[model samples]
Target: MAYKSRIVQIFIFIITNFFLLLIIDSASSQNILTIESRSDPATPEDCSNRWIHIRNLPSRFNLDLLTNCSDYPLFDDFCPYLANHGLGQKTHIRSRSWYRTDPLLLELIFHRRILEYPCLTDDPDVANAVFLPYYAAIDSLRYLYGPDVNSSFQHGMDLFQFLRSDEPGIWERNMGHDHFLVMARPAWDFSQPLNNDPPVWGTSFLELPEFYNITALVPEGRPWPLQEHAVPYPTSFHPQNLTYFEAWIQRVKRSRRTSLMLFAGGGGIGSAPNIRRSIRNECENGTIKNNISSSSSFNIVQRNGVYSKLCHIVDCSNGICEHDPIRYMKPMLQATFCLQPPGDTPTRRSTFDAITAGCIPVFFEELSAKTQYGWHLPADKFAEFSVFIPKEEVVFKGLRILDVLMGIPRSEVRRMRQSIVELIPRVMYRRHGSSLELRSKKDAFDIAIDGALQTIKDKLGDTLEH
Candidate 1:
């Protein structure tokens, strides 16, 4: 009995000590440096910390932006944020709502700078634009928070619509110009674009088309991928350039990030039965994503497989949601494998988000996983990167999610985490390619913004001479 007790005590001590070391080691991982606004705008609060300014928008937009950027909100005391809604913890008020931005809860938003893309294809328009302010708002947030900061504007909804509408030169007007779409809310109805007050306009500055003159001939440097040919704007790069770059850098920094992986699950706008049926068979039995039924939109029917009780599917539109941090913390932490099947291009945070929470992403092949970011996740490298499932084999073809995970070897799952840890430095960036410390040194955001701003500045430069 004495011997057994001593062994048990030693085990407990080791376990406790292990956790203590983990906490201490992880402390440095949380360092973040926010970009303070150079000029305080005519707004309610200073733009110093996370507080920002919009020319004619309400305080709501600014607050939301701050919330999105921080990923970790410090506004519990300052604003009526928790009460306002969707940061996960909901406080019933005049209406029921799902608050966004719970540290453990990940939500995706599809935003379009619909206004910035009014088809200004003129050569003069593309030359002198300075996209700094626009990018500053975006990249700065991305650095501090994980890819939890997600929005698609450039090549997502705006382009798809322009092409489908076949408006004269619409694609020509916006092609090759790199721009990020910052969004609030999750849909595309032109009327809903505006609320009670000043209209919230989607904004992005135009830059020279990718095919434009470039100093790519820098004697001795990585030959920058030639900007997409005369396509008018940078289409594929919009949604994931930041993370891909960051992941690439993360690999360099951590030397143990995941390498090859894919995230495959969920429909674009919401979970559609058709989508659910289609994705069921991609996996083997007893896998993670398999348990969640893909049959219903925003469907919680299959959630029990992931959760204990059938948690109430709270109404999301009105405001905050029932914040269940405990429910998600373990899931988020243990989910080294997350699935993001193909359906919509605009807002699929479900995929990238899996990356943020330290999960390896498993994707369906329908979307442009690699061509978009030069990221190729082969089976051998699967342990290093995301896993991409081709269209035909998605387990849920009226199949099952459990089968999907079972189909892949447990070795593959562990390999995915290895890839992510290795790629974290390269694919993710706080400043552009800066270290996790949010250092200003060429952050992944800066790399994208700098290339973009250089073009915009040149264009806007002439205009300022007046």
Candidate 2:
């Protein structure tokens, strides 16, 4: 009886020890999971792999420029654009998606969005890229319109000197190859030559050797690719959330496009004079040879029908389109094709606006859209959404813009319009403080940042291999 009791006690002791081990193991696993959950919460989907470190630039570079916004240009009021963190004044539109946005305020918009970026790291050691929050466009504005040509390069020179002296470690790390800045102005605005005989119109900021490796995000990039990249110019529509964005997309998709083509800009504005002038002359005269068919080749009438007006002109010659969204947006929403000729630069902000309204953009220059916005509009799919008519063909050959548009089949037009509708989200700049609930969707700013990071990554990788 004593031996039997001893065996039973031993078995009980063994069972209790085994159960305790299992319990301890389970508790350890729970603790580990808790630590992991606290350490690695969900980040924005687009920022999962990339982290950016925004350099702490001096106030003179950005804030001071905004404080003196009214003093820069005598004719234009920039204070309105400086409002809403560079989103410009909000319009009275019911949806609250549209603003009287100025295209030159992209630096403000980009800076605001990046502040809310999810993967921003305080540690520069771990950052995938660095952003210099210098408002290059605003800085240039001070000297661009001033009389002293030699002082044009002063601000940029001071900026680089400050970067080298104060943030030497960051500047020396890859020699600014991973650093990027946003310039709302065109690339030419900063590329003025110092040795020009009569002193050119722009500043010498881009010509500085310090700017060689830095990537410049501009509205219009140079024709021969360097470090300059073209980003979408800000349009009036800045949706606050995914729901509003989708609603606008649906509205544009369902719009009844009554007019065949639309031109909503002023003529006699840019270096390329003939293109816009020709368009204006053609639109005003309202006469084109009926070249749609061989039977009616000689008849001077609108091609589509006998008495119907095929082209719609908003006539922004009075300069009302710049501040008023209703003037241009309405015509674009009602037209099948929006004409995008070269504006003050090779590109125009109206191109993106037309896309927002789900109107197919008709380009007159290769640099206007094809070469400029490759980051937002894919090169392989350019034909899927836009139409291209060479400026030479239109200026020299007397090509009928209406006949070319009328030749496209109705089915093809519908397909192209649908493609443009799908691209609305990509070309738009989402409101600065909007929620990231729709993590799957990335906007124009998101695309630009991602592209910058990826390009830096590739360049760094190549350096390592070589």
Candidate 3:
């Protein structure tokens, strides 16, 4: 009788736990939103109605510059800096960061993707938009980091000469208004220098008159600019297919976020007053300790430009500071929020990584999210997904990072995390060397291409008419 009673109790406990897990899974699934790929059928009409890519441009200006030009192989000389169609060296087979794409290599990725696009045409007569397909970023990098900084301007000059001398009629076509160029770096890198301003380290690609009419799809577009469109900075998170992306979303959504927030970068010097340093200082000052218990996991990494020291003052693991994608993402996945201070410029690629990890980003500057309306993020949805505190208040003033974050209600934080998880696909670069063949699955590259084509159609109006 006693043995039978014990068996019955065990069965009941198993049934109760199983039902509870099902309920939890169902709740999480409710929050997971999948972006449906558009059902637009592929046809000759689709191809002809889309953008026309220019085939006459010098190969040296783009592909050869990436292939033969060997400058930035600090990791491995054999592996080209512009490998895997500008997605960089594949770092992992399962993770998109396996390729380890350089942040400034988006131009190479964009050019290749555009060439492989289903809408690409052999003739320009039946096209809506013209893509220049220039690797100006790579060319600039070769010169910028080289011994002669002034030589960077020559690449821009050479490109201008090619456009004027060889393709004069191409410029006359819509006066270059229907054309566009994709850049991997920030717009400031290629800005035209002012008369008395300190020397900046980029080519005057934006200053050239021929390029004035062209739309620039840059990682960081200047605010209040109409011609420049902000694209996602290349992040470490890359999903191979729809399955990988969906799996990641489900996994991150279900992660146990024990930490209030994390700061994964080093201190800054200019623009904003080293906000990361301020946050680190505040954490040490017992401000956060007074709010959360001593058992909390507030992991902070003291990173110099090269080496990083994981100051595991709390009960954090060694995996917190590992450079590998899984280890790097682990902390983010476990945190409620990720600190995103401006690095060199106002924008950081980690901002997108935070979104990809389903962690709400705490940004210091407005331009970090505000200027990026054209490609990845929606204009009006900033407040719904992220937390923004002005730099002056956070850094200059003695405001505590923990106090500000801990003040948000748990329900609101959950809502924000769900919103961020929904946005993962928008900011991720598709796995490189994947099938270019037509498929229903659409990734970040496909979305950007679609958006660009639509913008061109809207701008050209009757020009694309039959």
Scored by TM-score, the top model is 2
- The per-residue C-alpha lDDT of model 1 at residue 254 equals 42
Number of backbone collisions per candidate: 119, 0, 7
Question: Which ten residues in a row are the worst by lDDT in model 3?
Answer: 301-310
Worst-scoring 10-residue span by lDDT in model 2: 30-39
Model 1: residues with Cα > 4 Å off, grouped in runs? 1-129, 132-273, 277-329, 343-347, 368-383, 395-404, 407-412, 425-437, 440-444, 450-466
lDDT of 2 by residue, 287-349 (tens): 445535543442433354432457788878756788678789988988899999887688988
User: Distance from true position, residue 126, model 1, in Å?
Assistant: 16
Using TM-score as the measure, name the better of candidate 1 and candidate 3.
3
Ranking by TM-score: 2, 3, 1
Model 3 C-alpha RMSD to native: 15.1
From the highest lDDT down, the ranking of the candidates is 2, 3, 1
Candidate 1 lands at a TM-score of 0.37
Q: Assess the local accuracy of residue 305 in candidate 3 as a C-alpha lDDT between 0 and 100.
A: 24
- Prediction 1 global C-alpha lDDT: 0.31
Return the lDDT, model 1, position 138.
28
